[model samples]
Target: MTLRIALRPAPLLLRFILPRPSLLLHQLPTRRAGHGPGQRVIHYMGHQAGATQPPTPHKTIHFCSQCAGPVDLKFVSSEDRWRHICSACSHVHYLNPRNVVGCIVEHEDQVLLCRRGIQPQLGKWTVPAGYMELQESTAEGAARETLEEAGAAVEIVAPYVHFDIPGIGQAYLLFRARLAPPFTFAAQAPESLETRLFPLEDIPWDELAFSAVSLALRYYVEDRRSQSWRMHHGVIRKQAGAGPNDPGSFKLTDYMGLPLGAERIQTQA
Candidate 1:
């Protein structure tokens, strides 16, 4: 026996319904209630193509973490600067500079350098370094970054350089480190395209990645030449008429030791 199947149109209630013109007029409210004449009414149905968009929030932080409320920039008396404050909860969201920790691993008069596989300066050489994680000391972060990037286990000797980049809201703490026993390292890691040791006289100054790395290396070389090892503090400021990635774009101002090509300004004790 053959079975016959028949096709039928969908029921009227199940069909797509377009709103009546009068019903649309009542349902779609263009102007918000209680607004006086001459006030702007945001039309939700209007085409907003080619409209100017709002500026992006700094560091991509647009909402409060505690209450998930919309945040706006307001002057905080305690901070003495504009900070993001929650509209509903009145909570202040503090935006602070981030710390980057790393080590300058030294072995037999040579320093370990890694070619970055990531950006901001991809393919450029730098000492092993990355952002510091919470619950870890700066020295610990340095050793961990060194091991992860250059695959070398190192004993941090001392904090060598404290460099600040105010323009980018970052602080770099670089330490002098000695390679552990056996003095071996993997040629590359996940974050590094290549790794090599460069002697003091053979450092690729022009090919170095960040200003902080270059400045730290310069301090190390200067100290090595004088046979004196001391901690250094400095700030890297972007100079006018120079691009961010330009080698000569940044001016290094040393707060402790004398920086290259600049005389130290002495302050009265």
Candidate 2:
């Protein structure tokens, strides 16, 4: 007797040319994970790089910022997840994912990339990006990071990709940008060892610093090749049993064209 496993067809890519923000929010299912008892994991219908693992908190909070009091992890009933609650002042310290803003600095047919001088993935190439600073818009932060790391002033074109790495509590907001007037750049030290432009076909895929960078570059190349630009949303997750030193993979969960009349914001120098 012979036995075979039945496989289902992949889900169709849901595209919305000019979807309303409210409609998009309502249509997309929320992906959430919990660390409490009997946690449930939600996965979107998309291409999976490998086996998926439940989301984990990026870091543990030990003390409350409000009163400098010790905090304990407790499951909040309203939020339906665990949070660090202060035992002294009763202030709840909510841990939310951080926003990492960056830009894909484009000029002519080449894109700018920076080699890292820091410890994490040192010497690997990546787009200029870092944690968002306080009192700045996402676009402004992206541009600021580009200048700091790549020493290039860029004009924000449009929002490009929003990729969430829930396991590390980071949401990368990458934008498509072009070099401002003068079109000059250099590698800033400490943060970057070298900065250079690479044609789309010449991108150093094997030496990319992070999964987020690799995914963003791949999507950019795909859009350019097809001459159809779109905003992308997705997640980069680590495979089961993958260690911290392992290079993980990413999943493209959704993509959509910008809504009509979308306005471009100028990057603050």
Superposed by TM-score, candidate 1 places the C-alpha of residue 171 at a distance from the truth, in angstroms, of 1.1
Off by over 4 Å in 2: 1-59, 240-248, 254-263, 267-269
Candidate 1, lDDT over the whole model: 0.70
Per-residue lDDT of candidate 2, residues 1-269 (tens digit) = 11122333434444322221221211332221122243333434543435343344433878889988998877554544567789899898876899999999999989999999997899999999999999887888888899999999888887888877777789999999999877999999999999999999999988988777887787788777866666667555655554322443333333333321243455443
Across residues 1-269, which tens digit of lDDT does each residue of candidate 1 receive? 11122323322322211222111101221212113343232223543545444344454568889999998877544434567889989898787899999999999999999998888688898999999999887877888898899988887666788978887889999988888866788746559999999999999988888878887888788777876666666567766555434765776542344223221211111
TM-score of 1: 0.70
The whole-model lDDT of each prediction reads 0.70, 0.72
Error of 2 at 171 (Å): 0.9
Clashes of 2: 0
